[model samples]
Target: MSETAPTPAPAPKRRSTFLRDLVIIVVAALLASFLVKAYLVRSFWIPSGSMENTLMINDRVLVNELVPKVAPLRRGDVIVFRDPGGWLGPGMGDDLVKRVIGLPGDTVACCDARGRLSVNGHAVDEPYVVLSRGSDRVVRDDFSVTVPAGALWVMGDNRYDSADSRVHGTVPEADVVGRAFVITWPAGRWSVLSRYGDEWDGVPAP
Candidate 1:
């Protein structure tokens, strides 16, 4: 009686190994991306022109959520955070991006003689403020406020159009989502987002 020819060796061992290895590679890649998104960095889409010139609408940005863990949040950090209040309409959205103008316990004011936002008595040179190209204007109405303990005063690069901390008040430090570190979309606009921290140097600590 002829046997069943060993049933074609029950499928090749090599084929099984190849499939298993492929699965492992795929799973490993998926896991790496998840970890990076969870702890290292996260990508966000700009929904408005609030950060115009510096960050335009639809520009995708990469925020380093790892920053607060690595270093203290400081002035000039371009950050994303949950809405402090009316800044975001009901059910419209929550996350907003702005440059930190005031740290906890710091005072933020607008348009010092040269019309730049000043933080804690230091007159910062704000070259990032963008006015419609031909306008060359930079004052966004005079206002002053002190950032309460454990809160941050944030503003957009496009001051006039942005509804930020100046509108809804300071965001709790805990509400900060991350520090935006790069603009990753629109090839022509791709560049590392820089913080004006150097200018904060020598500025008195709050």
Candidate 2:
């Protein structure tokens, strides 16, 4: 009888190895992402009209959480901070984003002679303001107050609708979370949120 051809050796078992490698890759990616989010940047969503016109409801923003940890916050920086006075209400959560108008030991006021806002004796022209219905007829008014030491004066772009420093007074620097760097959602609206340098150019440093 003809000798039967030797059967081919069984193929090496590779499925297990491939699965293990894949799992390792996935785990590594997750760890890397978590570290980045914790120390470099993070995402936040707008929940109310407190910062309207500049930041709309449901807007997704990217925050540089690591910046404040490395450097001190400055005037005119738009920041996200933990809510004080329990303004957000019980169980409503913390964190409110607003523009920095005044820093520690600085004066913050609203409605300059030209219906603009002012900081440290310098008038700030805000083109981002969105006036509320019927309120537009009554031109913006003026008020003056100094920011207490270790605190900040913040406000929403939509002054008529926002409940900010005008309502709650100054916020402490320790409460600040991070500066908003970008609006990352709604693809078509993606853009960097840069500070209005001119507004703060002449204002004295605190």
Regions more than 4 Å wrong, model 2: 1-28, 132-141
List model 1 lDDT by residue over 140-164, tens digit each: 5888888889888888888788887
Which runs in model 1 stand beyond 4 Å of their true positions?
1-22, 132-138
Q: Global CA lDDT of candidate 1, please? A: 0.82
Candidate 2: residue pairs that collide: none
Candidate 2 per-residue lDDT, tens place, 1-206, comes to: 89999987544557677888999999999999999898878899888887777888889999998657887676667899998775687766688899888888887766655566667777776667787575531125567888888788888887777788877888888887899989998787798986787767778764
Best by lDDT: 1
Taking all chains together, the TM-score of candidate 1 against the true structure is 0.83
Models, CA RMSD each: 4.3, 3.9
- State the displacement of the C-alpha of residue 102, model 1, in Å, after optimal TM-score superposition: 0.6
